[model samples]
Target: MRLGPDTLGTLPAEIAQCGYDRAGQAIGVVHFGIGAFHRAHQAWYLDRAMAAGERDWAISALTLRSPTVAEQLGPQDGLYSLTERAGAGERTRVIGAVREVLFARPDAERAIERVAAPECRIVSFTVTEKGYCRAESGGLDLERAQESFYPVLSAALAQRAARGQAGVTLLSCDNLAGNGAVLHGLVREWLAAHSPDTLAWFEANCTSPSTMVDRIVPRTTEADLQALEERLGLEDRGAVFTERFSQWVIEDDFAARRPRWEELGVQMVADVAPYEAAKLRMLNGAHSLLAYCGLRAGHTYVHEAAGDPALRQLAERLMVDEAMPTLDPAPGQDLAAYARDLLTRFADPALRHRLDQIAMDGTQKIPQRWLDTAAWHCARGQAPGAIREAFDAWCWHLADARFVDDPEAKRLVRAASGGGRQTLLDACFGGGAGAPLWPEYAHLRPLFEGRRGGS
Candidate 1:
């Protein structure tokens, strides 16, 4: 059993010694939401940068939701495992890129200090789409009190305003359209309430650079833990495993020093809008569809769902026909290659991506996943059959039903369904379900008022 850092590996104290050689403190980026994905992806990229002797980019990992991660990681000298799983088996690698870790559980006061740290030049986030505390109009919503919700950027800018420190770039690596603008609005709202002067500093000196991060980080199960324990002969309480594929794209705009992240496979571009839209509409949207409909179709896990001949073809066709044509071309992205790679990653049996895990928060997720594209197609006089199928599946799944794994979403689902498809469509879309949309979407109303997952 791994009792401490001695059993896991050497403590990461060396990385924080300001050992950037020439760059002094090196890159001081504060990354929020310390989850398994950020550990395997962003932290790995920083490790690669450090190994290549590209000093100056060290990360301060911050957790806003859970305190367990902070407790476990802080003592082990900020130690964790990044096990890479592929077709063959699992390979274990220790990640030590995080020089420090902080918690924002109870409040944002201290968390804001870390983000506003003078040495902390770039503040990045893996806080996901819902964390920005934004409303439908893409402005800050003060009453964001959900589990995943937090006023992170808002508080950070307030700290900057009070300290007279400005000009720190805000980077959002979540999956959202124009994530920068989303974050910018959240920060601006906090500024308007707390410090309007600071908002000016942010606008003049800082920039919210939009970014898109893609990877398949499945839940690390007990089976994965057992496999890693045997392979390394070391027990890690926080060991996380993932399929072997990753990607990151950033719209290059920064106020202070940042890592040459492009040095290690990260693509820097003029704008990430097209790419973000493509991934959001196709990749993430499809993931949601498969998580619900695929499971109802009798598939157990994400791998099982992808391996299904019918479901696999459904995914490919949805991407090729319904999803791809809706978005413009990315600079260096090969749509065909990207789609193929996503399938391979999703199909990895060992990863065992949980169906319910993706299914949770459907109330918050479906707007972006299935509804947005469906509404767009409706306006263009086109029918979004595949997406509607997904919407219907989601509405059905929300009935405290066993479509995936969300009790909370299941409770809220009745608000959409229970009555009829038109009623559900009315609830999900409101006045803007599009003009021609309700008619095409009404085709599925009968199903919603009926039982779900009969097949």
Candidate 2:
């Protein structure tokens, strides 16, 4: 049987399911960018929260640029399965946190109206790093911002303000450091330029809490879907699979009604920067290193490369020697333990996390992942060899890889031309007059250029 409200009785008895009636919940949250990660992590949490009796936080998921998720889940009444795997064991649960789904392309106005609704107390999104439409200087890309989600969001805020509706919290679930604050600035910048009135109202009312979200949600494949069908004896078009590990550290700031997320395992803290910095550098940075360098060495998935002795050494060196020195975690937080967990997580063979997926948007990711740490090390008179090697791998990935999916791919490819290490670095760094560099940059070039076995 196909999964939907009508097929609820047909759901497998062994499958963990939501106990709450979907009709009992109101749409208190609207999540933009209904991708697999959002479904597996955020929606999964909300589903558990509602099932555990936090009934006021049902979600209405929206996809801005694509109708793919809506097309798949709408027929099922926004119900989908989240299969969490660890080693050979897996748990499947039907999620009903997303009570409604919207495709922004055809129903843009309705989406805006939903955001403006008084019932929608929280508006969160998982638009990837590039979806923010940030410029080279890390601010709002003015031209792109005009054509991006910011305008629609700004209009929604305008509608709310005009209707005298209460302001809502805007949470960003993307992997970017200081994601909420960054999103707040982008919205403020866009509104300051486009609608001053909305800007004034938003400044006085809304809150954007910075968040650090972690989960390994690989893109679903046909094989995964087929296996899920076999195991469950039902057709679930919106099924998503992810690793057993999941985390959400949010700065305790909210303008409206906050979901009882503490009951559902979300870490609400006084400060999120320390955690955010740690994850971005230690976990995400190492992932980038593995992606570019690993793929160049003929590995397809993260586990394949992370399991390799040479690649594992490189990752360890990058995290411990290069990345960790730049981070200062909270008093009780264990940075060393976190580093150990990152490697273990990456090496999970069950989760086929693709290097190419992690490698996308290299330009946007580099500033936070490697460049910032490299700059920090340089200011302290450190060499930062591992970071430089990663950059070299990134350049090579651009020049030689079968596919490059960066917005700046054309420019990066041009800059990656064969002259030497400096030429490639200069091109990748955009030929800036005062570009950041490590003391041992020159020495690091040959290692990457030679495609040496290890870091």
TM-score winner among the candidates? 2
Question: Can you write out model 1's per-residue Cα lDDT over 276-350, one digit (the tens) per residue?
Answer: 887887888889878887767767698898888877887777677777777788667778787887788788887
lDDT of each: 0.69, 0.84
What TM value does model 2 have? 0.93
Off by over 4 Å in 2: 417-423, 432-455
What's each prediction's clash count? 6, 0
Task: Give the per-residue Cα lDDT of candidate 1 at 108.
Answer: 58
**What would the TM-scores of all predictions be?**
0.86, 0.93
Q: Highest lDDT among the candidates is held by which one? A: 2
Q: lDDT for model 2, please.
A: 0.84
> In angstroms, how far off is 192's CA in candidate 2?
1.1
Q: Output the lDDT of residue 336, model 2.
A: 89
Segments in model 1 whose C-alpha atoms lie over 4 Å from true places: 1-5, 8-27, 106-109, 145-166, 403-411, 416-422, 431-455
How far residue 444's Cα lies from its native spot in candidate 2, in Å, is 12
RMSD of each: 4.7, 3.3
